[model samples]
Structure formats: structure tokens, C-alpha cells
Target: MAAALSLLLWAGAPAAAQRIVLPTGEYMDTTSLRNPGCGAPFYQYYQVKGKYPVASATLARQAQAFLQQRNGRYTGTGLITFRFGIDCEGKRLPWTKVLQTDAAYRPTHFAPALVEALYAYLQTLTDWRRASGPNREPANYLTLLSFRIQDGKVVAVTP
Candidate 1:
């Protein structure tokens, strides 16, 4: 009876599996992903309290500031999304990809250099917080950030 009860409790425990759902369809060779030294089941930031690179508003501001200096005046009216996993050590997984789309969500391409520059800038960040498992163990977190562009200017960022 005790064993059965234990099993029941275990089954009732919180889920630790990853739950990533992205609208990404196009493939981008933007950043050469490196092997993450950490293992996962990956979880979205929302799955764990306080497990994100920075507050959403602040993240957008920072990205805007960075891109303002590197936009190169290349024009595009579309959205770019970056999707990947971040390890406990704040390292990105070796499968990061970018997807670009027009305002109507149709697949499109932005200036390759501009997209590549943004990808490189993302890699330079080191403040991502790793999500914790239900058992309080380290778990890689899935990250997705979308950038809104207009005539080569980054007008907004969403995470």
C-alpha cells in the first residue's frame, strides 16, 4: 500500500519536460551553434519563475540600442525571430535558428548581413537565467525573441 501511495505522489509531481512551441519555419545559418555543455529537457521561461535573460521591456530596449549602431542602412520590412535553447551556464545550444517573415507572416528574407549581425550580438549576451526543474535542478531554457523592422530600422522587439 505504501509503494502504491508513493507512485501516486510521484505521478502528481510537477512536469519537468520541455514545452517549446515556435512559429519558426525558415532556416538561418546566422550563428554557428556550439555544443551546450548542459543537458536538458528544455523549458520555456514562463514554465519557471524568474528565468529569463532580462525583463521583457529591458531586453527590447537593449536589442534596439545594439541594432541602432549596426543596422548598416539595409532596408527590410519584416520580422525576424530567433529560437534556441540556453543552458544553465547561459550558453546557447548548437541549434539556434532565425526565421524571417513579412507582416502577413509569409516567409521572407531580410538582409543577410543585418540578420547575421543581430545573431552575433545575441551570442555576446551572458546574463540569461536558466530555468529550474520541479526538483530544483538546473534545466536549459528555450528562448525566442522576435524583432520588428521597418525600412532597415528596428522599431520593436518582442520576447
Candidate 2:
């Protein structure tokens, strides 16, 4: 009877298992769900709360600024892939680095810049799991971005 009651209470708890209690008494949990595309594009900033010291908006702005400043005066297209991980404790776990580099001779040199900017943006989100890899960096909150470049610009990006 005691075990049954305990189980019931546990099940009744919130869906977020690792709720981060903030200084303002707010709690944050990393939940996995797809972002339903509304009128605008989906960004990690809209999804996380108290998951990182920096806000998601700030990160996005930084990434955009970086790209806007760097993507100019370049041409061609390339692909960039990155991987990182997060755990139930909201801590970024160790993973592999899945960085793919294509030389300018193959396509263009703008691939790495787009990737770095995407990662800079990801540095601001919370509650994500990157696939386990051999050379991945460790963090409490993980962010992964895969960018598709076209015409010397990033045409599409995905988590």
C-alpha cells in the first residue's frame, strides 16, 4: 500500500524531471517537442526558460549579427553539421564532434562561418541532447545546428 501511494505521487509530478530553480523562484525543465510553425520561424529562444545564463533572444541576435557581418562578399554553397548533448540533469553531457568540412575547391569556404554562427546562437538555448560522439564538447545545455548554405548564404537550418 505504501509503495503504491508513493508511485502515484511520483507520477503526479510535473513532466519536467529536472526543474531548475532560479534565483527568482522560477523553475525550468527541458522538454522535447516539436515547434509548431506559426506565422514566423521557430527559434530556440522561444522554447527555453532559465535554461541558460543568457536569454535565447540575445543568442539569436548575436548569431544573426555574426552572419550578416561575415556572409557578405562570399559566394557559393556548402553544408555544415554539428552535434552536442544534454542530460536529464540539465547538464551538457560529453559527446562527439561531427564537424564536416568541405574545401573551397569542392564548393565554398563559407561553410565553417555559418556553422560557427549557428553554434554561437545555440550557446544560448537550453535542454537539448546531441547525439553521443567521440569529440563533442560537454555542457549542461546542448545545442546543435545543421545549416544548408546556398548562393553564399545560409538557406536553411535545423536542429
Best by lDDT: 1
lDDT, candidate 2, 54-82, per-residue tens? 44455445555666865544354665544
Error of 2 at 126 (Å): 2.5
Runs of candidate 1 exceeding 4 Å displacement: 1-24, 28-37
Instruction: Output the TM-score of candidate 1.
Output: 0.70
Q: Per-residue CA lDDT of candidate 1, range 7-78, in tens?
A: 211011111211222353544322333344556476786786434556666766777677777636667888
Question: What lDDT is reached at residue 103 by model 1?
Answer: 82
Supply candidate 1's per-residue lDDT for 69: 77
Top TM-score hit: 1
**lDDT per model vs. reference:** 0.62, 0.39
Candidate 1 Cα deviation (angstroms), residue 12: 38
